[model samples]
Target chain A: MNETLAGWLQILALVGALALSFRPLGDYLAHVLTCPRHWRVERLVYRVGGVRGDADQPWPAYLRGLLAFSAVSVLFLYAFQRLQNHLLLSVGTKPVAPDLAFNTAASFVTNTNWQSYSGESAMGHLVQMAGLAVQNFVSAAVGIAVVAALIRGFTRKKTDRVGNFWVDLTRIVLRVLLPISFVMAIVLVAGGTIQNFHGIQSITTIAGDHQSITGGPVASQEAIKELGTNGGGFYNANSTHPFENPNPFTNWLEIYLLLVIGFSLPRTFGRMVGDNRQGYAIVAVMGLVWAASVAIVTANELHSVSSSAGHAAGGMMEGKEQRFGIWASALFAVSTTLTSCGAVNSFHDSYTPGGGGMTIFNMMLGEIAPGGTGSGLYGILILAIVTVFVAGLMVGRTPEYLGKKLGAREMKFASLYILTTPGLVLVGAGLAMALPGERAAMLNSGQHGFSEVLYAFTSAANNNGSAFAGLSANTAWYNTALGLVMILGRFLPMVFVLALSGSLARQQPVPVTAGTLPTHRPQFVGLLTGVLLIVVGLTYFPALALGPLAEGLR
Target chain B: MAGSLTRLLRHHLAALRMLLVFTVITGIAYPLVVTGIAQAVFPHQANGSLVKDGGGPVASSLIGQRFNLPSQKGQPSGSPDPKWFQPRPSAAGPAGYDPKSSGASNLGPNNAGLVKAVRDRRTAVAAFDRVPPSSVPPDALTASGSGLDPDISPAYAYEQVNRVAKARSLDPAAVRKLVAEHVQGRTLGFLGQGRVNVIVLNHDLAALKRR
Candidate 1:
């Protein structure tokens, strides 16, 4: 079969899988979040933690619960990294440095999965499984839990209470994340992903040479790392590592897992709010944006345009596996960046200017085009609110979205949610460019070099953990700055989102009238998609112009 | 104010307790259970997919290995042994194909250094195989994502057949047949690219030499 034909078929299969699962998975999620009776294990967990699973909390209390858990998680993970040398399964690795430990802790807790340390050499088995992988489950659960609260905000009227944070978090982990991860982990192991307690094994080659191979509980981590949209690699090569993603089949499966929950989330939103068409409209917009990105990236890679190295090699093969080639690599890059799952099967820095730029652009769009696990649903919902607000201003009427009126408080929260990430990205990148020491860390010179800095900040602020790996980001400055960006990026938006949910919950839902905008219509979908593109595009245009566009055009 | 502080502490305490409980479930029990099942059902794969010669482990079928002559003192890279098919250029470690530090060159597409490296590799690979520079496949001139990638495109593998045949003093047609046998099509016909597993191919190549 022709490679181009294969690429098209692969895309069709992925979209088909996502479409098939959307209704059942989304409806299941809605059931999980809203159902009153707790599972036996959930009841046990709540009892052990002294949490009242039935008690609904106001938004402030819910926010407090989230913040407290995240804070504790960060501290515990930090301590685990610092004390790994003494821990079981230390396997000859040393304790991580203070700054790196702090950075790793914050990165994982925020669901960023960004890494400043090489996995094989820097981390031991205990830390990888118990510390990092544990956060993969909980942080993703926290994201879904937050979205559930927001959904309750839309569903309930004339009340300040959203939902119980403890209950939501527990149910998501035990019922949703863990069960799927368990099955996928075994499947990954069957496909040759290593799963063991062996440290580094020394072996001889067919030709007389010695090789040292590192081993760990990789399959388990690999499963949730993709399932939860946490793309931190157990190896530095991430998904590119043959053991981590042995064959093309495993590669496709990983991509599907990362995208499954994110794409289906709109259905959950629709079902909970009693409007399935509204969910369809939102998902349609997400699918359109996601498909556009995939097409642009795939075309740029297949042609190898705007890339001198690609031209010299006669194709874009650098930093790409022979098995995956250009098509699979580009697909993975677009999906990973569009969502907050930042695992790379190919190095983006080595991609053609247009291809790499589209990836950075994907992150700049706030990963909302079927974004992260729960983040995508909430991100697009906020944009929907903004779209309705903009439409209201144009038509000289009050805006109501999902029965909730868009007022000053709601609009303020939505605006801040939109502003937080781009602000962090620009300021962070600007600072890095201004400093000579940081500028020296870039491996490539000129415009591509500028892109490296821009890519890092955009990736961090968007909580998308992929990198232009040429940036040498393990430095003290990057570790601290990007770490700060990840935390602020992850939490600040949630603060606004939760506050907005609270405000929406307290409102008496407005009755539908002739002036009310029908948010479930195609008109609204087109308007929302335009708002997403124009808003994100306009904000990041200058930075992009100075970076990928300059290099690409030249 | 004091009451608020107490309440904050109480919230934090709940968080601490929840973290510990969840840690026991997700962090400890979850991984251990997966490991047990993987070890039980797929022990060979679970233990890094090592292939053995006689009783000794030779190499992992999945990991790409270098096929070069022993390095002379002060040489940055070893000379490619003409008797074996060479893998793609790697940027893994100080030396390439180091599994412990798996990574790419990470040089951007337009980077001057990367451009220079590509030119150098094309010339070197063409010279080694006694083929024209244009005939050398892109995979031959570029680095793999994991410097430890074990596979090379079928075109790259077939390109090296003549040189290996001449070096080993074997039938060129026979060597060509061997390369053809090793070419693996995309999984289920439309999933990925066609490629030859370098580690497995070379392992079989050694046996062919013995024959």
Candidate 2:
């Protein structure tokens, strides 16, 4: 069969799968977050932690609980890595260096999973399972928990309470994440993803060549790594590794897994706010951006234009797997980047200038094209607020969404949330380029080299963990700086989001009036999509022009 | 101030306790449960799908391997041995195809170094296989995503038949037939692309030669 047609069919299949799951999963999430009674296991967890499951906290207290949990998680993961040599399943791997350990800890805790250290060589089996995989479950739960609170802000009126953080956290993990991950992990093992505790083994081939192969609890982690939108790999090759993603079926499934929760979230939003069309409109905008990125990246790879190496090779085959070929790789790249799920079936650095640029551009858009699980819905909703504020200016109407008025206070929080990521991304990239030592870390020279630095900071700030890979980012400087960026980028936006939720919850519902714009219509989707593109384009155009645009044109 | 400090400390303690409890559930119990089932049900696959030669594990059918002449003192990186079908060029680690340090070359398509490498590889592969540079499959010339890619495009595999058959003093038709049998189509007819598993193909070829 023609590869292009096959690629389209795979996309259609993915879209079909996601569409089928949308309503049930979304409503299930809504139910999980708002349900009155806790499960027996959840009750046990709450009791063990001494958390009052029924006590609702105002937004500040909720924020404090979240911050405290995440802080403790970071410290624990760091210590785990630093002391892995003493841990069970250490597999003879040495303790990770201080800076790398801190970076890995923060990266996982933030749900970024931006791996600087090679997993097979640097980490023990124990750390991979206990430390990293644990965060994969909880950090993702944390993201969903935050979005649930924000959704509550829309549902409740004249109330300081969002919800109980402990209840939401426990329920999300025990009810949603764990069950899905268990089934998926078994399926992965059945499809040939390794699940074992064996260390590296020395093997001789038929032709008499020696090789050392690694074995660990890969399938279990692989399931959640994609399911949670956490992209850390058990091997340095990441999803490209045959052990993590063995075949085309596993490859397609991983892409679906990463995107499932993120896309389902809007339906959850629609269900919670008592307006399904509102959810549809948000999802429509996300779907449009995601579809466009997929098309551009796929087309760019097929043609092999703007890259001399591709021109010589007769196709853009560098850093791409044979089984997946161009189409599947392109699909994986776009989906991963669009959702802050940075598991790559192909390396972006070796892609055509246009293709690689689209991956970077996807992250620059704040990854809201059905983004990270809970983060995607909240990110797009925040943009929806900004869009309404802009729409209200032109129409001279009261900008109210779901009966919540977008007043000056709400607008400030939304605007700050929008601006924070770009500020960190640009400043971080700029600092990397300005320093000679950092500048020397680029694996490629010239304009393409500039892109490596830009891609790192963009991936870090958006919590999209995929890299251009040509950038040597394991140094003391990159690790520490990127670590800071990951934490700030992940948490700072949450602060504004939680604060906005608080402010929104405090406002009494303003009645729907003639002056209120009908945000549920297709017009709002178009307007929101336009605002998203224009905002990102304006913010990152100069930097892109210097990097991918220059290299491609040359 | 003292009251606020105490509250903060209390919050930290609670969070730490919760973290420990959750860790045991997700970290310890989750993986162990999955591993138990995986080992019980599909032990062969769960424990790295190792293909054996002479009743001992030789290589994983899933992972690609190097087929080169023994390295001389001057040529630390040995030349490709024509007796065996070579997998795609790898940039996994310092040498290539090192599973422990898996990665790609990560070179931008327009980099001078990459461009030159592609050019040189095309010429070298064409010369070695006794084929025109234009006929060289893209997979033959470019390094794979996982530098340890076990599969190669069917086109590349077919192109190697004549050379392998000649090196082994065997029938080209037999070698071609072997390559044909090894080519795997897309899963369920339309998921990825058609390809050949290099490791498995070569393993069978070694068996064929011995017979």
lDDT of 2 by residue, A112-144 (tens): 999999999899998999899999999999899
Clashes of each: 0, 0
Which regions of candidate 1 are displaced past 4 Å? B73-77, B209-211
Error of 1 at A411 (Å): 0.5
- The local distance difference test score of model 2 is 0.92
Q: Model 1, range A1-554, lDDT digits (tens) per residue?
A: 99989989988988999899999999999999999898998999999997778889999999999999999999999999999999899999998999999899999998899998899999999899989999999999999999999999999999999999999999999999999999999999999999999988888777766778879999999999999999999999999998899999999999999999999999999999999998999899999999999999999998998998899999999999999988899999999999999999999999999999999999998898899999988999999999999999999888889999888999999999999999999999999999999999999999999999999999999999999998988888999999999999999999999999999999998899988989888899899999998999899999999999999999
Whole-structure CA lDDT of model 1: 0.92
TM-score of 2: 0.99
Chain B of model 2: TM-score? 0.96
Clashing pairs in 2: none
Task: After superposing candidate 2 on the true structure, give the runs of residues whose Cα lies further than 4 Å from its correct spot.
Answer: B73-76, B209-211
| Quality of candidate 2 docking, DockQ | 0.88
Go through the candidates in order and give each one's DockQ. 0.86, 0.88
